[model samples]
Target: MHRKALLTLLKEHHPVTADEKAMTQATIEFVEANPACFERTLLIGHITASALIVSPDRQQVVLIHHRKLDRWLQPGGHADGDPDSRAVAFREAEEETGLTSLKLVSPAILDVDIHPIPARGDVPEHLHYDIRFLFEADPTEPFKLNEEVKDVQWVALNTITTRTNSVSVLRMVQKIN
Candidate 1:
């Protein structure tokens, strides 16, 4: 779960897009070049873990209305020095959605994204090298809202495109098998 581990995953993953390929390489370089890459102390950018969680039957996905970004996104958060991205993904999913029955569909990296986090308070704008994994949540379990999101819902997989225009969500949807 350390930087080395993430770097290894990046090097081995077969990225689907040119952007993803570039981002994967960039993340590997970043992890090697910056000792603080695993820690949030890296002001310019840092590693984050996320989960593209789907219902047990794979008919729907769980999305949160992110409070800071005002966007509906999969559950994820800063690693906060945690080397285990898989654990981070699981922890964040449960914390954000209150669904403890979730299980990782696979530990492999499903997606890699580098996005900017707008400045907040004294923290200047920074990039998040988000590492995403596929997960499945028990359809029978209910979820409760957390502080990070205004609301949480299970949206139909087929209707995700109409509900939101997020490429990450759409991309993950297509990859869900």
Candidate 2:
């Protein structure tokens, strides 16, 4: 049922760029081909969910310094066996950022990305079909960082480049603008 919901979301997603279009197609194909796409045990790759959390006024975005990756990124994580990407995104964001007043910007998917995660410990390198959602939260709300992240900050949208040079992050900023 969750897979079907994702399919419907992809169908209505209307990607914002050619790269996103390609990623959307790849995600559809991957999800369709793998029944256990939500399971991290699928060493080849697996589905992940993320939240592009923005300030209530939309001028700033919440970024987390991922402990393991040693880089700044949006709040997100593995779906485990849960297929509801929307819920996963919200849950991961709340857990990672400790923002209690998060509001879903929309029910629609904000973006889709397929990126490779490097091998770590016993885990092999694999692709992450990341489903992203837009969310709004009060930037003034103090965030309690969890073990998954080192720090959390509200970055001005114009100065996002200082945090990370991820192409996907820039693309999302463009979409927001």
All candidates' TM-scores? 0.95, 0.97
TM-score of 1: 0.95
Tens digits of per-residue lDDT, candidate 2, 47-146, equal 9999999887789999999999999999999999998998999999999999999999999999999999999999999999999999999888999989
Q: After superposition, how far is residue 118 of candidate 2 from its true place, in Å?
A: 0.5
Clashes of each: 2, 0
Report the C-alpha displacement of residue 93, candidate 2, in angstroms: 0.4
Best-fitting candidate, scored by TM-score = 2
Model 2: ten consecutive residues of lowest lDDT? 168-177
Candidate 2 clashes: the total is 0
Model 2: how far is 139 from its true place, Å? Answer: 1.2
lDDT of 2 at 77: 92
lDDT of 1 by residue, 26-91 (tens): 888888988788788889999999998998788999998899899899999999988888888899
Clashing pairs in 2: none
Structural RMSD, model 1: 1.3
